[model samples]
Structures are given as structure tokens and as C-alpha cells.
Target: MTLDRRTFLGTAAVATLAAPMVRAQGKPKVVVIGGGAGGATAARYIAKDSDGAIDVTLVEPTRKYYTCFFSNLYIGGFRDLASIGHTYGTLASDYGINVVHDWAVGVDRDAMTVTLTGGDTLPYDKLILSPGIDFVDGAVPGWDITAQNAMPHAYKAGSQSELLKAQVEAMPEGGLYAMVAPPNPYRCPPGPYERISMVAHVLKQTNPSAKILIVDPKQSFSKQALFEEGWQKHYGGMVERIGPDFGGANVSVNPDEMTVDIDGAVEKVDVCNVIPAMKAGRIAELAGVTDGNWAPVNASDMSTKADPDVYVLGDASAQGDMPKSGFSANSQAKVCANAVRGALTGSRVFPAKYANTCWSLIDENDGVKVGATYEATPDKIAKVDGFISQTGEDADLRKATYEESVGWYAGITADMFG
Candidate 1:
């Protein structure tokens, strides 16, 4: 069940091993759960490359998928909510993919079937699970999913994004906006910080007296220096960050009272964005592929260590050295799709190569990025090279970085849905 680089690359030899064919024409079936960056891209690639040789079905509950990558920009008024939303119609018409809008409730490994909440079961020769994330219970005391309305995480985007923005706008003058940041290994390391900057931008323009506070568990964060510099330059005296050195780790929120308890000290806030500890989406656990938290996946093909027939991608997977970003998921999906297609058919499987870049916008036309290229090794996905934006960079380079992110957003969405 443990697939090393050699075993994963040799998947073609096992192409003819799948049995109990479901289709009358003997076409192999692939059931993909979750329709975000990883799942959408994987389903698209497999269907596009197979050319009617395989049956690909993608199961996602949402009709219009709102990407988390640019949701921050939406909050900052740089982009509208509609600009970040996408539909699967083009993925269905152009690519010949079956996009099912429903929840995948269970997985039957022995029978090779996936059960939906609607009482229909889909049989598959290969299964891909890319469910993004769910917050851990009790990670933030006195806070849970039920309190999301009061303390909007807005981590998942869409309605939550709308709710959080509305709350920020409704805050009283000189009111405090607090954010309880997540721990290490969470999705989008710089995401919460970028959101802070966006919120700062809004407050500076509207409620100039409003204060922004970040309660972080980690000692350091991604692009820390860049974000700090931007905060000081753009919204001086409006932003504050408290790391673990100042009791940021021991924190809890009272949604009813709209107060935060940091190390036994209570501070009342107008709006609280509690991004608690996270794990693979519930479906991943229900599928019985997770190692308590995240599903361990092979570096070469993204197949889970629990079962080679099942693959985990994006935020649900625990592949070494790759931050869970939209770009990471897109990169992992291509590698997975290629390997899956090669395993189901006699198609050529290329060597696995992966890369990810996470871009964060501090203010208008001020962007920073961190990324690395990876290779499949016997141990894990090894980082080959990396880069990041430096402090004190000229405005032109920063603006160009922001523009590059704009182009990438269009390119990736087109690549996913088309």
C-alpha cells in the first residue's frame, strides 16, 4: 500500500489489473470528490486526455465555486465577488466531463464504489479525493461551526466572505477587528495575514480610527517581514500582531460577548475572524484514508499510503514540502491526472514535476510571493529551488508581481473549469 517513487512510476504495468468493470463498453470509471482546485483540475485533465476512453465523474455540492485564492482581494475592494466565482458548465460542455452537484458521503474500497447523499452509488476504478479543509473541534474554546455567523472565519469564501466584509463595514468607529490565526501546516500560510492587510485597507479608507489585531499561534509566519513592512508603511499605527511570545497561542473567543481571551486577559472586539486549527475535509476522514489528520500521499502520483487505488490531492494530502495553496493543488492535480490516466490506459506517463507559488497582496499594486519547484524522490516531494520577494523592493517590481498574480488567476481558473 506504500507507494514509493518506483512503484508509482510503474503504475502502467498495473493498468490491466482493474477488474469488475462497471461500464458496458469496458470504459474505466474515475470518481472524483470535491470540485476545487485539485479535484476540478484532475477531473478535467483525465477526461481531456483520455478522449472517451474513461468515465470521469466529479462530485461537488456547490453550483458556483468561489476560489479562496483571491477572496482577500474581494474584501479589499480590488475585485468583486462575482469575479472570484466560477461555474462548471464549461468543464462539462467543453471537456466532456460529468460534473455532479452533490455531496459524496461514503467510499466503499472493497466494492470500488462511492456513495452519494442522494442514495446513488458510483463505482470507480480510480478515486480522487480533494476535499479542502474543516476546522478542528475544540481547537478554539467556546467557538465552533455554530458560531461562524457571529465570528466569521471567511476561510472558505463565498457567503462567509460576504458576511465577514459586511461585519467589518458595520463596525463602530475606532472599534477593534481581531483575527485568531491558525497554526502551522494549515492551508495558505500567508492567507490570514493578507486578509489582515485587506481589512486594514478597508478601514483606512472608511473607518480610519478602527484598529486591527492579529493573534497568532506560530512564532513566525510566511512573508512576515514583507507584511510587517507593508503594515507599517501603508496603515501605520492601525495594525498590531501578537505572536506566541505574548500569549497568542492560548486564546479563546466568546461569540456572544464579542470578546477574546488571550492568556486570561479579555479584550472586547467588534468583529472576530477565528481561523481555528484545520484538518482534511470530513469526507477524507469518512473515506478512511486519513492518518488521523491528513492522508499521506505518494510523491510521484499522489496515491494515498492507505490504498493505491485512492489518491488524495490539495489541502487534504500531506505531501512533504508543499504548502497547501491553489497553485500547489493545481500542480499536484496535473501530476495525479497524468498518473491516473496512464494507470487506467496504456498512455505515456511522464516523470512527475511539481511547483507552487503563493502570492499575497498587501495593498493595491503591492504584492509578494514565495514558491518552490519540487521533484518526486523515494522519500517525498523534494524541494529543488525556491524564491521570495525581498524587503525594500521598488514599487514597479511589486506592481508587476501583483499584475502577474492577476494573469495567473485567469489562467488557472480557465485551466480548472475549461
Candidate 2:
């Protein structure tokens, strides 16, 4: 029997049993929805760790996934779309995962089956939901899908990202680029700032006369000091930030008009990226797994509060103190995978350590990162020690860190998809 890297990592930590002994007459069927950071990891781990004792199926609309982690680089012209986009062909060909290319329309929790948009129903003994997030329609009034055609959010990862990049490229040399940052509890706390940094990097070369404005609802943000320092040092006078004190710059937008009403002041811009407030994907609501915007789950195993056999990870799950980032989602998926394995095989699940490190580019050669490890308590996730990054120590170290981020992306994508 051949095992892929994902399966090998999952099974390597477990004690070995005879192959025949592990095989059951009828193995438990696990169906996972979404194949982004969380769902892909959980599906791969369950199939791999069970060592042919579990039947795993993954349902996702796209055959390829483009990560938001390094997408800023793509916007800044450092990386290409192909480099960031990954395929699940490896997951299907190497790991024996039944990859279903379809959108899940609804989930029938009572029947324990997932209903597809095409009218097929997949029954599962255990289901994992990690559908990521969706934009809140009315969070910013006047912003809808049609309006998004003119002003791109570029938050979701694929076409939107490309559209934003195209708009930025087509901008006049002295034009303005405005990005409205969403409120808290959104995916990637530091993402908007990093996006500004990358866009500034591009403007520095192409459109030095252009300026970037960030209209934020909050005064303070993640990595505030570092980002400010970088902006002053690298792209001084080219970037401006208006926080809550300045009337919050809170606005209802008119996407069709390409205009925003900020605190009774209406302004029109050449390019706008309105990142709306977010919630767990619609599937969470359909499954009755969400409380408000997020799915409540046990911190220990990531099992849903509504159903113990159903686990939720990724941006959709409510993890206290941990921001919604891909690295965090990947770590949570591993813990959830272990918990599901324990429940299926009647084995003990030891306490696990979750680690997350997210790197943001301050410029092409400079970067900053925040990392932490956590121990799961009964109700919430508590941070552990020994999780810090190198401060403004040396120029050489910053350059090396930027290079390391590329390696991390490769390693993480391999861990999740390989």
C-alpha cells in the first residue's frame, strides 16, 4: 500500500496496527465540504490517518484553489496567479480521496447527508464543514454582486483578486485607490494592511504620483506600528489612513455610481475595494450550525455545538483570540482530524499544540510576522509561550524572513494538498 505525504504525516504519529486488523467490514464515511485551507486539510488527514479504514469524500466547486496568504504578492507583481493557484488532482490521484467537483447546495443534518446543487445527496457518518466566509450583503449598504463588478472586493481569492489587480494596473498615474477595511472578526486580521503595503510597492515603481487611502472603521489595527513605520520609511506621503476618529469614514457606498458617502461627505474614486463585513459561509446557516456570523464549536476538538459528530474549522469556526488566517485554519484542521480519528477508532486523543505564523510584506524585501502557539481549554483557545518573531533587529534578518515566507507557502500548501 502506497501513502502520500499528507497520509504519511497523519499516520506517522500514530502507533501501528496490523493492516488487516485496522480494516473494518464497513468503514465510517466522512464527507467534507469546501476544499480551501481547512476542509482540504481535514479531508486529507482523515483519509490518510485511517490507513484505508475510512471512506473520505471532498466536495468543492473549484478544481483549483488560490490562497489569499500570498495574493498580495500577486497584486504587487511579485508572483503569478499560477504560482498561487493549486489543484486537488494530487489529492485524488495519490491519496484515494473521492474528490467531487460540485457545489453543496444544502445540508440535511437530520439525515446526515449533504445535498448537491445537481440533486445528488451524499450520506456521511461524520461531516466536516469548513466553507470559509462570505461577505455580509447589507454590512455596507449599496454594495452587492453587481456593484462588485465596478468596485472589486478581491477578498474571496480568485477572480476578484484578478479584477482588482487589473483595475490597479489600469489606473492613471495620479489617480487615487481607496480600500474600505471591514470590521473585526473578518478573515486575516493583518490582510488589509499587507494589501496596502503591496499596492504601495507597485505604485512606487509604476504610478508614483498615485496615492492609496485606507478608510478604516477602527483606530488601531493589527501590526499598526510596524506598518506605519514601513509606510513612512518606504512609501512616505503616498499612503493615507483615515480611522474612526475622522468620523469613522464609515460610509454607505453606491457601487453603481462608484461613489462612497463617508460621514455625510460623498467622494468618488477611480478604484475602490470595499471589503464588507463577513460571516461563515452560507452552508453554515443552512445546516443550522451558526450563531450570528460564526459557527460555535468546542475548542478542544472543533466539533460544532449543535452537533458533536460535525466538526467545523477554518474561518467559519469561532476560535477566540486566534485571528482567522490560513495558518491557523490548517492547525485547527489537524486537531479536528485527530479528534475525529479518536472518536472513530476509540483511541485516546492527547492534548494538541496549535501554532500559527502569518507573514506580511512591508515591501519587496522587508516583512513582518506574528506567530503564537495555543493550548485549548474547555471553552476557549489560550495562547502558550515561545511564539514570537524577530523584531526590527537587522536588515539581513528581514530579507531572510521575506525569503522564508515563500518556503512557508510551499510547505503549507504541501501539507494541506500533497
Query: lDDT (CA) for every model shown?
Result: 0.90, 0.83
Instruction: Kindly state the number of residue pairs that clash in model 2.
Output: 0
- Clashes per prediction? 0, 0
Indicate which candidate wins on lDDT. Answer: 1
C-alpha RMSD by candidate, in order: 5.9, 3.6
Expressed as tens digits, the lDDT of each residue in 194-240 for candidate 2 is 99998888888999999998889987988888888889989999999
Candidate 1 segments exceeding 4 Å error: 1-25
TM-score to true structure, per model: 0.94, 0.94
Task: Report the C-alpha lDDT of model 1 over 109-180, residue by residue, as the tens digit.
Answer: 999999999999999999999999988999999899999999999999899999999999899999999999
| lDDT for model 2 | 0.83
TM-score of 1: 0.94
